[model samples]
Target: MYVQIDLDGPAGTLRVSGHGLPTVELLRSPGAAPDPLVPLGTRDPARLTLTVDGAPARIRPAKGRLSRRSYRVDAIVSGTRYRLVPCSYGESRLTRDGRPLGTLESTGDGRVDADWAPGATPLDQALGTALAAAFGTGAQPWWQTAADLAAELIP
Candidate 1:
């Protein structure tokens, strides 16, 4: 399966194309699963105009074979970043400028909790931990903590 994810950013745009999507439930729907793709471009996903202040944003994928829940997305409401993960029962971690910042782990009932590094957080820790803790899931994304997470991890 193949999918295309486009994220709008400030100044320009961020685009990612790849083989699959993240297993985080934040992307899924109440009863759907969508296959996500990682953009092979030299940059991370694009940042959109959607923010905490803007209206709800939209994510358009190439296909819908995956669960609808897998395609669920939410804007941070403040920054130019938007989150795409399983919605009903998944978790997600975030990185800033390619650095791990924090994570959002799902509690399995459509309520994902967050846990970022006091300073420097890991990109794929919360998602990995949530999946493991919930369903013994196994799939690692190149996660790393950004300077913020690193600050917490080291300092």
Candidate 2:
């Protein structure tokens, strides 16, 4: 199944909609601060929450080192763990318990395309797509890019 995530919704909102799935609205928030001891370079572990059919789920940065080139975000829906691992490109893979659930690709036009596996459930479709949209699928902010460049040059 295919779904499209619209990032151009009202500020701090992401809309996920497509065939075979109900429209879901994810609310974005800068939840809590990352652990000071953990090394997250130029990456903000923002939090996202969404409710689908009265079931609420939360997505947040997993505990680990998040750098400019790689990062991991996680969401739990109906007791199933979904992880989104994004690469440098405008692409990300959605995994469930280490198994591939789907793929999300950014079109660089304020939208993301999500292709789901054959066995994915409706909740899986909604949550996975929302996670990818909330995590973002584009180049880093200019300030962050510049800071990373400066850090590399200083060493």
Candidate 3:
């Protein structure tokens, strides 16, 4: 199955479309923390709460640095775990229990293309598309980008 995720909509909105998967729209609530680091001069990190098809869902940074080579975010929906692992550039891999599920590639804009493996369920398509829309890019918050650069220079 092939899914397309558009993140360029209004702020905090994600639109997902695919052949076998039902179109899903996810909304992000303000002040939900998905990253460990808070923006500079901010008191708290921004929290991320996504509403998937009118149901609340949670996604958070699970491992690695967002600005580094390896970074991953985990989202659980419908009792299934969908892992979005970012690779070089604007590409990401979605996995479940160490099994390859799909590949998400960003177009350097805000569009992402997701190609899922055969036998993937609807839940996988929806949640994987959501995860890719949320974190499939190489972009990061300005503060986080600066911090990463500083770390590299100082190390």
Candidate 4:
């Protein structure tokens, strides 16, 4: 599972990708703490790859950086791509095109919450709506489906 977030302003391109077999629990976690890299749906790390904008970036657990569960993804993107990576996730955020938007967060409880602060933009609102549609309200277990695999862009 992954998300390509394009933000406007000085922020850069930001992407959230799940290297191994992604689970509802893993994705929904606020990631308040870093945990050891565990292979998704297996006892070992699942071999995976992501090619963004024609460049391949490997995603894996940090060796000695286990304290930080977040994988270190290479930032090979440039230009506007770099400007959308740090938009604050909240209401009233602007899109890369400078549109009014709102930010949405997925609650571990299977509910999608959206905060609409002042100056919110459409991109933010679209993200919230997209999350609810993509992740849904519970463990839909769609990843196991054939359609899900293709949708994930797994060649």
- TM-score per prediction, in order, is 0.28, 0.64, 0.63, 0.23
Instruction: At residue 142, give the lDDT of candidate 2.
Output: 47
Which candidate leads the pack in lDDT? 2
Cα error, residue 14 of model 4, in Å, equals 20
Candidates sorted on lDDT, descending: 2, 3, 1, 4
TM-score of 1: 0.28
Tell me how many residue pairs clash in candidate 1.
Answer: 52
Top candidate by TM-score:
2
Per-residue CA lDDT of model 1 for 1-155, tens digit only, reads 23232332121222223244332222222222211232211111132122111233333322212343333343332233433343233345444334545555543232234555565322233233323222211122213213444667774
Local distance difference test, each candidate: 0.31, 0.61, 0.59, 0.28
**Residues 17-81 of candidate 3: C-alpha lDDT, one tens digit per residue:** 77777666655455443332311111121345555666766566544444543456776666666
lDDT of 4 by residue, 1-155 (tens): 23333211111112322333111111212222322222121111233222333454332322222221122111112221111111322211223334434444442222335546575433333333333322222222223344665777965
Off by over 4 Å in 3: 1-6, 18-20, 31-46, 62-70, 138-155
Angstrom error of the Cα, residue 82, model 1: value is: 5.9
